[model samples]
Target chain A: MQPAVSHGDRPRLPIQAILRQTQDLPVLPGAIMRVIQLTGNSDATSRAIADAIGMDQAVTAKVLRLANSSFYGLPRKVTSLQEAVILLGFRTVRLIAMVAGTFTWMTRPLKGYDLPPRQLMRHSMGLALGAQMIARIGQFDPEEAFVAGLLADIGKIAIDNCIDGKISLMMQLGIKGGMTFEDVERTVLGHTHSEIGAHMAENWNLPQEIVEGIRWHHNPLGSGNSWLAHAIHLADVLAMVTGYGLGGDGLQYQLCEESLEICRVSAEDFDGLVEQFVGAVLHGEALLEGMG
Target chain B: MDVRQWNLSFGSQSGGGLSSHQFSVGLAEIRVVNGPTLLECQGIGSCIAVIAYDAHACVSGVAHIILPKRLPSSSSDRPGTFMDTAVEYLLNELVKAGAVAERLKWAYAGGSDFVHLASGASLPALELGRRNSEAAKSELSRLGAEVVGNDTGGTTGRDVSFCTADGDVKVRTVHEGEKTICNLQ
Candidate 1:
């Protein structure tokens, strides 16, 4: 339903619904999923992971060459995947997989949403990285946190495909309300990204934690499930503040008190997280470009 | 200065005898068949440029644009066509002109972040110029081409020229009473 208010004012909904409407979400690009499956301590050996990578020679070569590029800021050039993993680490590699494999899909022009690919990629990666920092500060599973952060807005693609003209309309309302894209999602789509993403998770049969992470990412204040969601919520906001990955939602963020309580993540701690997250993401940029 | 010694040339859709590879930022697509060519457009506030060159053929092409993808200046909805499509088209033309994909030297200019100072039409929360630059860079990267020169960003306007014969490009900025050469080193 249209928000029917005059253009000067319109309703903004939560992000859950926006997450509900993703179209052609970039899959984990088989090899990346394979790496995730193989990298476990028990499932496979480094040789196995190497074999899987070697099978897709193109992505592997690209990742290795990228890893060796100036992005890593390595004092010495790394010529092999083993060296890349040793240097960039497995967790970083996983994050890179998620980004490199998926970022391009985000680049598809969202006419209904009026968002270019680069806009969404920057926003999504910024929040994902921000969440990882917050989770690390709180001693939660940072890897899970990063994944949660990355998938926080999976519902947006769905929204763009489902709501016809609403995305662009919401974009206009967003500016009027001083609201972010998420707010527009809520207004136009009725729910928020967290809810939409949560539902998507349920459909995809994603792990229970990821589903909850999607649901509570924006409203972390009242979350009873995991600190990862709250951490991601904070990171999303922080990314906007730092000008890292800005979306339709700019600095019009109102801190979710309940989410803050759920994580017990302090302001001082958050400040530190932002500082460190910036450094890590900056370093990670090269790694993401050169996945191994 | 687009006519200076071994420095510059302007090109458009029609063939020009100026320098073998001079650049033209004017909205016309210019073609050159001899030596090299540099075509350009400048002073783009929220505009982007396309650079397609054949290193083997020693020829380069450029286009300056104002949107991400192309849409009608009137009412056609082509949101997925702008500097990106223009670059792709130019590149395809270069290939037809006997330019190798990997040998093209590429660069661009004229995008500035616009935070609309005045309230006129409803403005979305978009960094149009930044978006344009990103699209251009992404297309170039995908094609294995890197921007060798650029003078992007800021509130000031830009003017640029390209030399096809030698692949020399110049970018100038309008600041106060002087037009300063803005270099991206």
Candidate 2:
């Protein structure tokens, strides 16, 4: 489908420029980071991870509630972090940390950019889920892919914070400036979100690949075709197209040649990926309907 | 602390590049010239680094480039002027710095071509990282510099530092010992 150009040709806001912001969407809250570390570490134990989860009252509450919630439908109340970890495996436990981390961030509002509190959260969580499907399809570590996809646009949140209400000004500049929003940011802000994110990654001590993925998702070209950068880039766009949670990115869909080539994404596959994602999101949304 | 002699890390196929360090991003002034020595770029992941060291003269140079190719319109970030480009470019810089291409030894670090091989569009093959390695290798061979050592592939991130004044190259991953990417005989 073609991108609809509105009357007056409303200038495109870069739904993507979030990729070029000055820093990472603030580091995962420290507690969440600890959980992520434990989940990713092979030496970490269920008890240890469970202990870590138990530290966050919110997550601890979520685990117990979800385990007993209608979703699991156990005969009796499943008590303790030990039971939750035993039932959920390390992989599932890691996923929980990711969700908890995601919730902590997505719950906030990214004003000046037009994303209502839950709007960006819904979009971010949706992308994260869809990215996992892509990872599974391609046979990589789906969980890690989910994290990559989930945090891909973290840079955008920075732009909203840095520029304030000027997001509208930047949006106007995007189409009129004949710039891909990135040009406008560089022109106004001196650096793009990608650089900011890479900078943020260094500051927050995130793994280089995750930082790279965040920095280059918008312009896969600069990332130099490193598979992690390229795959995550494509996953980001694909998730957007599927309409999982469209954010403030101006809905621009001019695909990058290098990213498409590296992902081997054809017209058919592109459409297929979107359809598959839309379905996946629908399934997840349905299952978690009762909960926020 | 194990006070081993200084070593270095270079690159061929790679995943990431120089992430953690006290060095400045615009810290663009140091250039290697003459001697049997080492060169380095630390905090490397998927990206590849290219090293050219002339052990006989105790001179060396190291470069770290992030991608397989630059964007079509990215004339600003020239591939030939980047990390690997700088490594290969060192030959000319070395000639000026008082060293010959034949006298130089080479090393590489931080490449895992298959780290995320799940994007299965494999016609071009799931070998972006290896292809990068191959590209760097071809360029080095063309320059007549002898490749003395390498640490590429497998899922690991490496930190590399080199000293051209003494012909040393050092590679450090999370748990692995510092191996010299350039162990020129």
Candidate 1 global CA lDDT score: 0.55
Candidate 2 lDDT (Cα, whole model)? Answer: 0.55
Q: DockQ values for all predictions?
A: 0.03, 0.01
- After superposition, the stretches of candidate 1 with alpha carbons farther than 4 Å from their true spots are A1-23, A40-43, A55-58, A69-71, A74-76, A79-83, A86-88, A162-168, A171-183, A199-205, A221-223, A261-264, A268-277, A288-292, B1-185
| Deviation of model 2 at B3, angstroms | 78
Which lDDT value does model 2 have at A9?
38
RMSD of 1: 15.1
Error of 1 at B112 (Å): 20
- Kept native contacts, as fractions per model, are 0.00, 0.00
CA lDDT, candidate 2, residue B103: 71
Name model 2 segments beyond 4 Å from true: A1-27, A63-79, A286-291, B1-185
